[model samples]
Structure formats: C-alpha cells, structure tokens
Target: DQIILLKDGRIAETGHFEDLMAAGQTFCQLISEYAVTHRGQDGSGSSSGADSDNAETQSQDMVGSGTGGDTAAAGTTPTSRDTRAKDAKKDAKKDKKAGIIQAENILDGGLSASIFLRYLRAITYKYATLIMLFQVLMQVCYVGTSLWLKYWIGQNEDTSPESRPSLSLFLSVFSGLTLVYVLMGIVLFWVAFGVARIRASEYLHRIFMSRIMRLPPAFFDTTPLGRIINRVSSDFASIDDRIPWKLFEAIGHAVSLVASLTVVAFTTPLFLVASPFIALIYYYVQKHYQRASQAVKRICRATQSPIFQHFQETLAGVSTIRAMNLQGRFIATSAERSDLYSNSFIALAYGIRWMEILVQMVNVVITLLASLWFVLLPQGSVNAATAGLALSFAMSNSQSLIWFARTYSDLYVHMIAVERVQEYAELRTEAPLSTAPDSETGRALEHHWPQEGRI
Candidate 1:
C-alpha cells in the first residue's frame, strides 16, 4: 500500500489502502481545494493560464508526498521509476479521451452468433420432438372426429326403405366415438399444458437472465429499460402462453386426424386422392403464414424501440409535460406510435388473411366436389356402401386439413417467438480485463516466478 504522488501530480503506484494514505494520495484533496478556489469560474472556462497555474500548484503540493514513498522498504530503489512517470502521463491522456469514446468503439461482432446459438439450441432441443408429437396426436383426434361425424350423418340420410329412423348402428357408433374423441382431447390438452409449463420455464428463464446479465452496459444506455424488461419478461411470457396452446392443438388434433383418415382410406383410395389438393392448399397457406410471421416479428421488434423511448421520456418528464402544458404534444406523439404499431400489425397479417381465405375456399371446394361425385355416380357404378363411406371420408379430411392449417399458422407464430429468443441470446458481449500496471507487469514473470527468479 505504499504510494508515490509523483512530481507531475498523478497517481504513481500503491500497495494497500492504509499505506497509500500514509504515503499521501492527496490528489483528491488538492482537486477539492482547486475546485473551491475556482467556484465562481465553474461555468466559464476562463483563461488557459488559470488552468495551467492550477496544475503547477497541485504538483507543488505533492513534492513532500513523493519523498515518503521514495524511501523504499529495506534497501530497494523503485525499479522502473522513469517508465512509471511516462506511463502515468500517457494514462492521464487516455483517461481524458475515454469519455468521448463510447463503449461501442471497442465492440466486436464475433460474439453475436455464439450467443444466439446457445439460446436457440437450448430451446429447440428441449421442445422440438415433444411439440411435434403433440401436434401429431391432436391432428389424429381432429380428423377422426370429423370423418366419424360425416359417416353418421350420411348413414342417417341413406336410411333403409323398410326401417324407421331409430337405433341405427352408424348413429350409435358415431355418438360413442365422438364423445370419446372430445374427452380424450380435453385430457391431452391438460397433459400438454403441464408438460409445456415444466419445459417452458426452464429454458425461457435461464436464457433471458443470461442474455440480460451478459449484455454490456452500453446496450442499456441506448436501449430502454422498459423495452428490455418487456422483451425478457412480457414478450417471453406471451410466447410461453401461445406456444403451449398451439402445441396442444397440434398434438390432440393430429392423432385423431391420422386415425380418422385411416378409417376412410380403408373404404376407398379415392378419398386419399382428393386429400392431396387440400394438402397442397394447406402447404401454400403454411408458407404464407411463415412469411407473415417473420414480418410481424420484425415489425414488433422495431415498434418496441420507439414505444419504449416515448414511454421513458413521458415517465421522466411528467412534471415538464405538466409545467410546459405540452400534454397534447405527448398525446400526439403517442398516437403516432400507436398508429405505426397498428399499421405494422395490419401489414403483417395481410398475408395470413389471404391465406386463410384461400384455405377456407379450397376446403369448401373439396367438400362440394366430393358431394358431386357421390350424387352423380350411378347407384351401382360403385359399391353403394363404399361410395358413401368414401364421401364421408372426403368431408372429414377437408375439415381436418383446415384444423391442420390452423395449427401450422399457430406454429409460425411460435417460431417467431423462438427467433426472438434466439436474437436476445445471441447479443454481443465483451470481457474487459483490468489494465492495472501490477497485473500487466506480472504477466512477464508468471512462467519464471518463484523458480529461476527466486532469491
């Protein structure tokens, strides 16, 4: 803790706090005196000569302070005394420039990709297969229910000439199967929800915390606190809610769907033939959904910045707003941001709207075409039971495809959430090391220390 307040009036070196104080680190004390003397000239830079005079006075004050530490412990002379003075002068110049050079000056872009992958891999590895499984199961239930419903309705319409409409076997089976389908869906949803909560919290929270903590202070300087808080907290929370619900739908519906389609394919291959066009239509819709989702995600992130800025400004200047009577200006600015947000949302959803319409229209076409085939075919041109069953299958498949389309649409949104999480996780970082003279000096001695360099 020994110190030398050098002749040029900057810190020389120190070993410990008490030793430095005894050695007189009175730079602060002298600066305080200079400030007191120049109190009236604070705002006005005054004369350059006055500034020079202050520096000389401060150095003179340190003359006695250096002598105390110059007498070293035992019989040693300070080894790099000349180099130390030169370096101290250079250090002061760097400090003077430091304020003007922002944290961004030293930034390296290399950290971004590494950070993004760390978060992305964590979430995907945990949820990808589980989510896919859930979707498959959900589709199965959805398709099964629709086909069974169609079969029951068609059977009722084609009642035998000799019988009254009572206790038909088709009606009985449909009713029982539909009930089971609905009940199973409810249970699957609960299961999906439980699973999602368990996994969602694990990855989401850790990634969010790690990203925020690792980000440099410069990031916070430009980025609003509210926006960062919202991204890490509210946005991720929304993603959590949206993802699990979508996943549950995809699973429960997917299972019933495959089962229902299997029952129909058993009766006729024609039903499967009709489904591909519907699948094609669905594929188109899903592509559009992905495009829209990515667009929305970009817009949402852009919107957050300005909104956060305005929000912070309003919060910080509430008194100013009131005193200046500029509430109307603030209101107008807020409205402008709101309008921007609205337009961005509308633009993002435009593709989705068209896609949904096309999907629904294609579905209707599918159903109408199936009905035409059923009605126009001669009574025995195809087996009556088989044709009837195939028509039932076609109708169910169309409905199931619509559900699948919806699930895919939801999947696109969830992927946007995933992308956002990835973006946050991939933020750039730096590991600034202290450039203290002691630490720098030790590096050269590290390998040889206490061995060849001993006594």
Candidate 2:
C-alpha cells in the first residue's frame, strides 16, 4: 500500500493498484461461486454462508483493502469506495473497447503540487505583471468615475448644482474604461482557451496517458476501477477547469477589488470605514451560505447517483417493463426522483436568495446612512459644490465595494468546480516496470530521426 499525506499532514489515501485488481478478480469469482451454490436448504445447494464471515470478508476485503485510507479517515470522502471501484472498472472497459487511452484517466495522472505550481508560475509569470498594470489603470478610472457620479447625483439634490459637469466628465471616462475592460476580457479568454486546448491540457494529457500506460502491472491489480476513473476524469477536469477560471478569475478579481478600494479610500477617507464593516458582514454571510450550499450539493450528488442507477436499470430492462406494462410505474418513479432533485436545488436556491436579500439590505442601509449624513450637517454641509462631488464619489465607491463583496460569495460558489477539477489533476500514477531497452531504443531512434539527414 502507498500512503500519502495531504497538505494538512493527514493521511490522504492508501492503496496499491495491484491489490485492487487482485481483489476485484477474486470478488468476481467469489460472486459467481456464490450464485451457483445458492439454493434453499431442501437437500440442495444453497447460499447458506453467503453473508457469513468468510464470504462477507471476501467481498469486504475486495473493496476495503485498497480503500484503507477511506476506512481509517475520521470523515468519509464524498464518494464511497465501492462506487469508485465500479466507475474505475467501467472506465477501463470503455477504454479497452475504444482502443484509445482515456482522456479522463490521463488528466487524473497530471502533475503534483510542486510540479503543478511550477507550471502555473511559468505560465502566468509573463502575463500576470502586465495584467496587474491594466488592473491598476482600471481601478483609477473606476475611482474617477465614482467621484464624478457622486457629484452628478449630488448636484441634482437641494442647493446649487455645481458638480454636474465634473460628474458628466467622469461618467464619460468611466464608460470608456469599462469598454476597454470588456475588450481585454474577450482577448484574454481567446488566448487562454486557445492555449489550453492546443498546448496545456492536450500536452499534459499525452504525458499523463503515457505514464499511466506504463504503470507497473501491480498498480492496476490493486487499484479500484472507480478511483482510477475518478483520477482520470475528475482530476484532469480540475486542472483544465482551474487554468481558465480559478486562476484567471482570482487574478482579475483581486486586482479589480483592490484597485477599486484604493480609489474609494483616496477619494473619501470617511468612506474607508464602510469597507471593513461591509467585508466583515460579507464574510459572516459567506460562511453561512457556504455551509448550506455544500450540504445542498452533497444531497444533489447523492440523489444523482441513485437516479442514474435507476436510469440504467430501466434501459437495460426496458423489454421486461414493456411486457409487464409497468412503463408508467417506472416513469412515475423517475418523475418522483426528478422532483426530489428539483426540490433539493430549489432549497439551495432559496438559501442563496435569502443571502442575496441580506446583502442588498446591507447595501441599502449603507447608502441611506451616507445620504443622510450628506444632507444634514449644518456648517461644513459639504458646501453645495463639493457636497455633490463628494456624494457622487461616495455612492460610486460604495457601490463598487458592494460589487466586490458580492463577487467573493460567487467566487466561493464557483470554487467547488475548481476543486473538483483539482482533485483529478492531483491523482498519483505508478511508474513503468520496465525501462526502454537501450539497443531497441537506439534502433528506433535511428529509424525515426535519421540523424545523418538521410532519406
């Protein structure tokens, strides 16, 4: 068994692919034998000991031995060992039938933390700094717009209208800046998608498949088909998904958020007070929403498995159902299951809606408070001219802050997808048992490369 520790210094998982394979093979034989021997206790063979220790042990050991990590862990992983094992087998069989390496499997066997980080660094290093520059400029424009917007709105309020022109000017600049951001966003997506499809995922997939194909025979024998399939499918997806979204979104959002805040602080020091308070509220709300969402997601996933199982069962036994005229029953049952799934989602959405309502309430409260302060205040009552400018700036900045806060929750929600993809990308693969023969390697190289430039 190979036991690896997670970043948290806890044992991650333990298993040898070889052991899983042997267990699987043994399980199949045992199942067949049990089926043949099964009968009533009426002077005939029967499955008397089917659930006995000996038989039970064989079945349990088949799935449990390689899944020792899951058994030992304090909390259960999302997927069960048996489910994982089954999926792996299905994937392997699919691959064999297709006569091509599984893309999912290959994806799972990608780089580890150290290697993956290094790759990420190399990929982002060149563009990251440039992106930051653009981000700073965008932030400046945002602040400029915020100040002008406040002035514009304030000018329309009681007292003389002095800040109107400044507000209009700021609005024009802000709109232009926003258009630029949109254009940049489009360009970035184009480049990232092209690179990932052509170079990143494809290249990694190739290397991963090559390594997987060369893994020691024992590795295959001990590992569950589902776990392996998960690594290939889920893990690969993690990496692929991360490259375009998590990585990019994190970078883009962080820059924008910081820049927008910087403008707010510079324009109105008093406004800075709202930032931390709003952030804290957002954090508190996010923690609650995240927990609820996670629970909802787990339920959703659980419901999906049984639904899928029933789907397959129905398809496989369609003839029997038709003959028995039980198609309506199956349809009704499916509809019920689907309703359950929908309800689970609705519950989740309701939770999100409540959170959103709370967020909006906070924003409204903040806006009202700021407006009240600007309206009253006897002496320094923000001199009609500056008051308009100050209010416009404050509103814009506050709105921007609210926007940033909202994005954090949205980001948290989206991170589930990122983690799923990462899980697959971090899967481990065993090394090849045999190295290339030096003589054969040389001959193959000579035949292919033709180093002398011969035809």
Candidate 3:
C-alpha cells in the first residue's frame, strides 16, 4: 500500500502505507484522530457514557468508513480523501482541455434558430399537418364569435325590434359558441399539452439518459452530476410542464392579435393607415426588450449551474461540514449563489417594467386617436358594428401588444433550457452502432485497417 501526503495543497510525502503507519507520521495521526473523534468513544477511557454516545456512534457509522467498511483490496492503498478530491479535479481539467464550450455557443447561437419549432417537430411532427389546420379552424371560430357578437350589438342599436332575431335564437347561438370555446380548451389541454408534452419529455429523457450513460468518463469528470441532473430533470420539467401551455397561449395570443388587426382594418379601412406606425413602435420596443431580457436570463441560467453544484457538494460533505463547523460558510456560499441568480432576474424585471411603461404610453395615444376619430366624425359614417369592433381592440390594444411581447420573451427564455437539453442530447456517446460514427474510432480504423488486412 502506498501513501501520498499533501501539505499547503502540495504533495509532501510519498511512500508505502505500512511505512507511513510505522513512522507515526501525519498520515497515521490523522487516521487515528479522525476514527476516534468520529466514533465518539470517551477518549478519557471511562465506560459510563450517556445515550448521546450511542447516537453519535450510529451517525458515524452512517457517514464514516469504519473498520468494517474500510477494507481496500489487498493490492490497493486507501488514498486520503483529499487526494481523491484533487485527482478528480485534475481529471475534470483534462476533460475540459479536450473539449471546451465555445464562445459562439454561449454568446451568439447557443439557443438554436427557431427553438420553439424544434420542440414542435419533436412533439407534433406526426400530426403537424392536422394540428396546423385544426389550430386555424379553432382560431377562426374564436374570431367569428367576436364578429357575431359585434354585429348583434349593432343590430340592436340600429334595427327595429320586429326586424331583430328573437331572444331565444340569440341565446341559442351564443350558447353554442360558448360550448365550442369550452371544447376547444378541453381538446387543447388533453390532446395538445397532455399527450404531446408527456411523450416528448419521455422521449427526450430516454435519449438524454442513454447518451449520459454512454459518455466518456472524462465528461463526468468535468461536469458535476448535479448539473447533468439539472439539465434532464428540472430543465426538461419546465419544457414538459410549462412550455406546452405557454406555446399554446402564445399561439392563441398571436391569432388574436392578427385577427384583431385585420378586423379593424377591414371594417374601418382607414385604420390600416395608423397600423404601420403602431406596429413599428411595437416591433422596436419588443426587439429591444427581448435583447436585454434574454441576455440577463442567460446569465441567470449560467450562474444557476453553480448553485446546483454547490448543493450536491454540500450534501455529500455534510459530515465534514459539521465536523469542521463550517455550516455558516457553506450557507453563505449558497446565499451568494442565490443572490447572483436573483440579481439577473431583477435586471430582467426592470427591463420589463421599462417596456411596459413605453407600451402603455403608446397605447394611450392610440386609444385617444381612435376615440376622437370615431367621436368627432359624423355619426353614420362608420357603422355601429365597425365602431364597436374597432374601439374594443383599441381599448385593449396596449395589453394585447404587451402580452404578445411578454409571451414571446417567455418562449425564448424557455427554449434556452430546451437548447441546453438538446446539447446534452447530442453529447458524444460510447456504445454507438447505428448512430453517427465516432470520429476518433473511425479515423483509427481507417489508418490501421489497410495494414492489418494486407496479409
């Protein structure tokens, strides 16, 4: 058995384990002290001890490598825990030197282009055509309900009671549309989110776990187990549990936005003249907002990796922490990690606030302009139906525009997690036959096969 000793974080002694133990050196002294202190037997040699002694012994057995658990193979020496830790760090550094995360991946294109579409392809490819047509039909029905309600209100204002539809007919029509809306939600929840999200998460988990298992040992050296778990577990949980609903809501809002704009332009054709200016402002504001928000969110996500890493480290070394009474230091480190993530989140919230203020101000101007145009103009110039429809959109125009921007931003942020999971999904693997050929293995075979086969 060999023993290597470290002092000032540098190796200070190297020799056979039996020689070190006989020398009564630091290595032997540490082992004896640690075992006795952990075992909690009265160092005073008194036999009378309280129940606390028994409790401490039980705790030590759970945590410590006692005599029963300390057996190393005959040819092996139990290296100091500190040496094992240092060796692990060295291996991780070696792996990092082999393959590093690039600046381009972090700063520019880490989030793949059209990430949401990627998820859609993963989850909905088989039924994509059917889903697309169904979504359009659903949106049309939704818009039609609004249109019908507007027309009915206009009819009540302008037409005689005798010319109007009976109360029962109006109630029946409204009730049917209401039922249709409920059914749309049910279908969206059960089929769109439930089936799709669960299946996608399951498939992603399978491939992700498979790749992880097949990865080279060096990969695990550099990457903490917690980080890997964070990616496929918490990160994917967001994609599975949250992204589907967010995507569904985003699609609904987008359809509503288009439908509202189109309805306003069609019924009051002059409204299209103002549409471009409002759209230009909305586009500029949203673009700036997302740029800032996504950057902060990226930082937030990066810092979060360390938080998970620290949590696992603390958990595994809890006994050491308690023995050294460094709980305060560990807790402070945890808080610091939390604050790092929270600071970025606060920055994101501030940017959102600024965007909301600008969006609301623009909305007020648009609202006033629309109100004055309808009010100052001759009464019969714009029909009651058109006026009602146009004004309704104008009243909530700010909210819809802001809602779209927020939802778009949220979708992008969520896709960062998807991109990360995808990165892991594409990580280099070990047992590969049908998958892409391993470059190193392929090159070696190509170089040596000719020489071996020439015989």
Worst 10 residues of 2 by lDDT: 35-44
After superposing candidate 1, which stretches have Cα over 4 Å from the reference?
Answer: 1-183, 252-282, 381-393, 396-399, 428-455
Cα lDDT of model 2 by residue, 391-454, tens digit: 5544554444444444544444433433444443455656433445565433233334555766
- Model-by-model lDDT, in order? 0.58, 0.53, 0.69
Candidate 2 overall Cα lDDT vs. reference?
A: 0.53
**lDDT value, candidate 3, whole model:** 0.69
C-alpha lDDT of residue 355 in model 1: 65
Candidate 1: Cα lDDT at 174 = 61
Worst 10 residues of 3 by lDDT: 68-77
Judge candidate 2 at residue 436 and give its lDDT.
56
Instruction: Give the candidate order by descending lDDT.
Output: 3, 1, 2
* TM-score, one value per model: 0.59, 0.52, 0.69
lDDT of 1 by residue, 10-52 (tens): 5565465435433444543333234323432342364444443
RMSD (Cα, Å) of model 2: 15.9
Between candidates 1 and 3, which one is better according to lDDT? 3
> Candidate 3 residues 1-455, lDDT tens each?
67789999989778876555445557655554444343333233433243234433443353345432232111123243324334545665688787753222344433566666767777867654445555666777777788778878878988898988777877788778778877876776676766877777777777777887889988877677767776766688778877766666777677777776676667655566777897898889988888887888778777777788899999999999999999999999999999998999899899888888988987786777677778888878878777777788876667877787788787777778787777877887775553334565452334344666563
Error of 3 at 191 (Å): 1.9
The TM-score-based order of candidates, best leading, equals 3, 1, 2
Superposed model 3: Cα runs more than 4 Å off: 1-110, 126-132, 431-455
